[model samples]
Target: MKRFASITLRLLISGVLLVLLFREHDLFADIAPRFHSLLTNWHWTLAGMGFAFLSLFLASVRWHIILRGLVPSLPFPMVLQAELISAFFNISSVGVVGGDTYKIMALSRRLPGQTMPVSVSLVLDHLTGLISVAILFTACMLARSSQWNEIGYDMRMLITGYAMYVGGALVGLVISWFSFTPSLLAWGRRTFPRTMGNPKLTGLIARLTQVHAVFALLWRRTISAMAVSTAMHAAFFVSFYCGLRAVGGAAPVLDVLTSMPIVDAAASLPVSISGLGVRERTFEALLAGLAQVPEAVGVSASLAGWIFSLFWGVVGGILFLRAKHAAHIAPEAQCA
Candidate 1:
């Protein structure tokens, strides 16, 4: 019943977001014009692809670093495959929270005995990435406040509210990090057995402890992974800039680099499925005035980004599947 309710709500939200994204007739008319002009910017288009590939590779490195201690013998290529597969799942889901569960599952299947450690590595990777993104968005919001001021009151308020939310989230994360100890979970189990449910909650509590312990052992590596992830994020923003230029929008590259993360974070809301319509709507809403271009141009830029991501993600998926197949074959061949 609970699962059904959740799926039903997600479907409803997806429908609403799609409507919001496509309801603007003027926007669609602008897309053809924007696409026609932007298609000519082959240089920026290629640059975007390059940056995206670099970003993916860097993300793979981050994962490798995280797993180095736990699964030291695992090949970098295999880890890269996992990263790509994870990204593919994330894009496919388009929900607020996607990919991590799939990623953990994939890693567990591939690494066998290293499942628990790999899962811990992923948790640390995700936590640090989330913190970095929140910090980046907050910084970008503060830096771009002046430009937003020239736009209008509502825009300013929206940015302000978003900043506050990010700020709160960062603080909350810090607090949780400090408070997340084994004792806390034990207390929770005892205090709220009804809410906590059965063995699943108990298992989860044990997993959290194990994750924290593993994290302590790999803190240095985890930090290194986060640094690589940050670089990758920067590369992704640059890709978005190229996409903007491709669409004939003469937006400042720095502005896009600074603003893109927050734009993406906002679009991550459950408003649209797999970020379908939300991506277009977000670009239109934020970039239209700032770039001094038609909303259609912003929409085109967003679509271009989605295109680059999907293409690379597909490449990753092929590699991931190949690696998985090889892993399966290797043991069988040895036995034979």
Candidate 2:
């Protein structure tokens, strides 16, 4: 009942926000024209989807590498299957790993005593994607130069927010590093013996220490995974750029690329289900600010970008159900 209510609330939020966007932007008037544009430029839509899938494939490969650090026997097909399943549920998506709680929990159930290790793997996976976001965002900012002033205050604020988010993540990593270091761990154990006595917390720290070991042991694999993550983000940027073209919008690819990381970050926020209204609103503001893109085109292209995610998510849902029905693989299959 609690879960149901949370879902209901998210649905309400999405509906309210979208309705507001439609009214504010006069999106009602552009609905017919937007559909007409998409129908006519179906090829770009198709290409965008191809890139989205390519991004998915790359994501799977990266996850597979990370898992191999802990679960060496884990198969790539299984990792791919999980990505598809998680994609549909919006627990994870194209470009960003998002909150990988589903994947972590699923893996934890399988690994039993190794829940912490599995969690560490997910952390590493998320870190790879996050580092990529910081890199990509910084690159975009550098590429934008002073013309960035053209995007208006709201857009600049969004960029600033994203920068701060990146900065915070970096700080968090540093703190995590300190906490995990041998000296800090010793200091913590001395300073908080009660916490050290907590089996659960102690075990978690132990698992994190093992993660440190994994990093040392599998540094090459870690690098490979991050490299793949970077390429995956690149694919997502191109795919969204394709969406604008598909919608008959003239937003520059560079500008679209610059804004997309922000769009994805906003969408990844837990506020809206599958980022429905939030994604549209954030992208709409960006396109309007960055390129003077028509509100209709901005919204249309945003939805168009969502289609790639939706398409693969549906495919994943099918695979998920199929695996669920198969008695033999159900236990292992659902872990993905």
Candidate 3:
């Protein structure tokens, strides 16, 4: 019942926002026609599609690099297949940890006793992406430093809020990194002796401490993974720009690049289904403030970018089915 209520509320929120967006714009005239232009702008559409796939592929490569560091015998093709299948889950819930959970389960099955290491690798994989996002957003903001006075106060606050969120996330991650260390664990036990006295808490910390060596397996590769992911996210933002051109909307490369990090972060928030209404609103608002672009174009481009991503999600669905079928076939063949 709790999960049902959460889903219902998300559906309601998304429906309400979409209705409000459309009530202010002519759907048949503006949004629908722009979608049709995707076919007309075939060149841009293809470019967008290519970039979208490149982003997904690069992400897989980063994960493969991290996981390979730990399990040197794990084949790249196996890791790549796992990452490709994850896209299906990623699109399904957007912000939920479906893809990550799937990867953990699948890899844990193969590796047996290495669940902690596998989980750590996935966590580090996402950390690299977040670090890249913070870097890219900062660079873009610096490049636009001269236009600070032109941005509205509300917009400035919004950007500042996002900056704080990124900073807080990094801080939390750093604390978590330290928590896996003996020094922080000892400090925690001393700081809150009573709380740390609980049997469950002690057991949990003991388990975590046992896995401390896994960090050594992954720590050095963090830099290399971040380097790869920077290009990965750059491809993703450029894909958004291609989506804008696909819809015949105009915005400078820098403006689109700057606007998308905010859009991506907002869309990753779990309030709405697949960030349906939220993505469109954030994209439209950022472009309007940063580039003086029209709302209609922003909305259309946001939807276009999502649809391009959804294309890969659909492909992943097929791949997932094929993998499942092959699994079944291998069992039957083994019996024969």
lDDT of each: 0.73, 0.81, 0.86
Candidate numbers, best TM-score first, in rank order: 3, 2, 1
Q: Return the lDDT, model 3, position 135.
A: 88
- Clashing residue pairs in all predictions, respectively, total 1, 0, 0
Q: On lDDT, who's better, 2 or 3?
A: 3
Q: Compute each candidate's TM-score over C-alphas.
A: 0.82, 0.87, 0.92
Model 3: colliding residue pairs: none
lDDT tens digits by residue: candidate 2, 1-336: 776676677778889999998887666577446757767899998988998898999998988898887787777887787787788767333223433655666566666776766677776887889988788888888988878667678778878988998899889877776678788888988999998879999888987887776777777888898899989998987888888898888877888888888889888776678899999988888888888998878888888888877899889879868866785677777887
lDDT of 1 by residue, 1-336 (tens): 765666567678767765665566354575666666555888888888888888888988887887888888888977776677777776766343466777677778777876677777877777767766765666665776676658667666666677777778778866665656767766876898887667776677567677777777888987787778788888887888888888787787756765677677766776555676766776677776555656767778887877778778777677667877998999999999
- lDDT by residue (1-336, candidate 3, tens digit) is 777788788888899989988887778887999998899999999999999999989998898888888788888777777777787888886344578898898888888897877887886788789999988888988999999889899889998999899899989867766787878878888899999889998887776665455555666777788988999999999998999999999889999988888899888877888888999999999899888889999999999999888899889889989988999999899999
Q: Which stretches of candidate 2 lie over 4 Å from their true place?
A: 26-28, 91-116, 194-210, 328-336
List the lowest-lDDT window of 10 residues for candidate 1: 19-28
How much is 174 displaced in model 3, in angstroms?
3.5
